[model samples]
Target: MRTLTRPAARRHIERVFDATVLDVLNSVDLVDLRVVVLQGGEQGGPPAIAIICESLGQIDLGWIETGDAPVAWRAAAYRALDQSLGRVLPIYGYQYLFDEIAMYYWDGETEDDAARQSLIAYHGADADELENMALPSEMNARRPAWMIAANAAASKRLPTALRRKLDTLDRASKALGGLESERNAWNCDFEIIQDYIPGYEECSSLPPLTLVPFEQFARELDDIARNGMEMGFMDIAGLCPLPDADRIDDWFTALRRGVQLLVAAQDLIRLDPTQL
Candidate 1:
């Protein structure tokens, strides 16, 4: 039931990204950096990561002679760095600001904090960035209100499509284990539901019925019921610490919502046999 704080999640991404960038930088002799670090964004601004290097002492490169050594390194490292951080950032619930290996030089003070930071500071002007808005990280912030409806069983009953999907998921959960009660928010079965339907994880308000062909969705559910839970154990894990009482309170704050999703698949399947 414990949720990750923004600061903690941001730090996790930063650490992972720094390590990945350094490994990429060391892969080639063209780039020699004294220090590399990640500076997190302010209020959802893009994160700035820089690999500060004074000179490429070992390489006698045509590009260095042309004053495009950093540009060459960025071109070589862009794909590797992007793939690495793309895998890391989302798991911590933050957007990946597409940043790259940029160059800055300091001859007098390699170790001075203020001097080193001067060139890398956020300028409030955009440069050396690629804009890719098509893909967003899956682990972005969750909207608790959307996933668990406010009054699912009462006057604010969810649309038929959501209720139907939830019912299907509730059945698939039976194929494995499940959230035994409201006490268990970190249940593996529920996690499975979240996995199969990203709308649940992202708390996206998109209509569930149209996202995938119902027949395929139902087959996946049956396949999971037959096979997913056991394999899920290998990948799906619980939160580090245990859930607290407050989590339990939040779990059932809207009992009506819980009821809307708990209907039996047998009953639901009867209404529309195609889903099965």
Candidate 2:
């Protein structure tokens, strides 16, 4: 992980960004990559899609791998997953539409700044130059798993028709924060989150996890679904498109089957907190 002294980090952000207090970006880097094939159904389909899932305390986000799959298919992130963030902000990038771009971050230059700052990040097309730079991709995993667990465990949002068995749910209940694992899971999850997105709670924009019974601190995911926000805070990567000569028409939310499950939940589940 590349780091900058406090002053250096400030200069770097000002150099690349428009220097708007409205949207402050902190750091950017190309972290890792993966390879998988496609399997399109209707709304979403990509048989081969590489996906990475991560969790911190209560914040759970994912990364998607875009770009051509390697011939060997078994590349490593140099075991980048095994290391800690060292309190550094990790920004990333992607192709917005036709152009390629990298992602950047913000919030927490110091412990205090990190505690209570809110900044919007981006993917590709630099704020100053608006140039397309190549992002890095390092793939070295033996076999990446398809992981798309919901970030929300509260609201009783589980679907009536999705068919996740009770025993099955019971097993993954800690991450889901359900059954006996309710508040117990929430406390455990929150501490784990500090490691990944340290000082996230101090940001008022983010939802708080009160010890007041069972709650899900997934307001970021809600923002993404509601506001059409691009990948920044709680991010996703690696999308596949079926392109055409006239204009690209066939597009899928390429988490492969994992996304398919969410889409199914969306269709089958109603917006009722009592559903769970």
Candidate 3:
């Protein structure tokens, strides 16, 4: 039998917690549940629920019946999941206090047709192509230009300020088009995969767990946090640093702008699995 180290044990526990959240989402009738991962900056990690929005903002009675009161129930659900997982799992070395909100939508017969069409259009294959082609990985690696085009179309419908920000992002995407092989560009692609599809499991034929220990992990979470902080400060500093003010103001502004763009893009992208 393999001996599980503290970190290994903690990871197993975290997986269980993640699995639990997946179960809850899978069983419910909620159209779509968004799960945002929250992460802490330091060793004393602060874990919190980032956001939870239901489809059409309808309250599901099944969710509420299971000890989830109607009042601020989203936070309550997060706390319940946190407490349950914390009790059974050891969370060490998972210092990044990020909360991943898994958006789960109800799967139905309608989804089958959409999935078929998406598979045919994207890979020139049908459902059986799961064995022949790694569609998700391919799509994730090099997102279709159509996706951004769709986003651009949607952004035009937004308010003036947000539309301008989306236009800037479109420009940025265009500027970076041919440079996808660059380190920074690849990082951006990976970040999107991590953010939007946190629990994406590779096909069964592939290795089950790809996550590595802290020392073995390729990316440094702390470095990412520090870089984000620094970038924020520099943005606030603008062309010249202020005499006495903190430099993160510009960073926050940029962050807000980026978020607005995402919101606008989300509105444009039909997230419906059936829509594909």
Candidate 4:
């Protein structure tokens, strides 16, 4: 990223285009005798080269007057210039030229040339292939904890319904003492059943209660399970908000019908009737 002001970028493009025109024209001898003689200052130069240069020069003048140039040639010229400069240019200047000058009908050129050149100049070569290259080891390294926290904060700006759900989940987890248990057992190797009672309570409380329908609840649980398997438990922990423990008993009672429906479906699908 070489930072360039708008005017500077435009001037750079104009200069490159002018140089290309001159380079093409200088190789011919269609110009006046004085100009042709001037081009022959070096020994062993072909006269035909002078003629071609002059012809190209005249063509370039006409192109400048009409504000148009051949696309393939323009692309080649720009590519060469980009390679020499070793920096990306702003897309605005190219877009301006394409809209203003290239879109109109011009002598000896089609709009496709201008469009193709613009595309190449903006997108560069084979972006997909370039993306396939492996990232640096440093980029793959774990990010700082603060960065993770900041990102989580940014993403947590949920709609009111989702926010209430999250609040409910938090209260449920707190009532079940999940957070405290995790903190207490942080450094200990002990696997205590009491520590997991909160988790069981949280799940038990989530059934038919809350705004989430039974089918939606099942989908969310499935999503949590899949996410956990792929990204780890911590990543999937927030998939479901904590339910309200105070309302769990009533909620579960209300969901009995849904539960029975699910159980019936499961029983019907079982290979053996006894398995139900």
- Candidate 3, residue 244: how far the Cα is off, in Å: 37
Off by over 4 Å in 4: 1-147, 153-157, 178-276
Overall lDDT per candidate, in order of appearance: 0.28, 0.25, 0.30, 0.26
lDDT of 2: 0.25
Model 4 TM-score (2 dp): 0.16
In the range 87-202, model 1's lDDT, one tens digit per residue, is 11111110111110111222222233432343345422223321211111211122111112221243124345435544454444443233343333223343434433234344
Candidate 2, which ten residues in sequence have the lowest lDDT sum?
93-102
Residues 160-191, candidate 2: write the lDDT tens digits: 32224322322232222222221121122333
Cα lDDT tens digits for candidate 4, 130-191: 44422222221222221122223221443343234334433332333332222221111112
**TM-score of predicted structure 1:** 0.18
RMSD over all Cα atoms, model 4: 38.6
1-276 in candidate 3: lDDT tens per residue?
Answer: 989999999899679756755554453332333444444323323332222323221122232123322223222222222222211111211212111100011111124344445556654675666455423233233422221222233433444543443355454333333222221211122233333334322311111111112232223333333433333211110011112223224323332332333333333221221221
Ranking by lDDT: 3, 1, 4, 2
TM-score of each: 0.18, 0.18, 0.19, 0.16
Off by over 4 Å in 3: 41-45, 54-276
lDDT comparison, 2 vs 3, better candidate: 3
Query: Residue 119 error for model 2, in Å?
Result: 14
Decide which is better by TM-score, 1 or 3: 3
Residue ranges of candidate 1 with Cα displaced over 4 Å: 34-46, 56-276
Candidates sorted on TM-score, descending? 3, 1, 2, 4
TM-score quality measure for candidate 2: 0.18
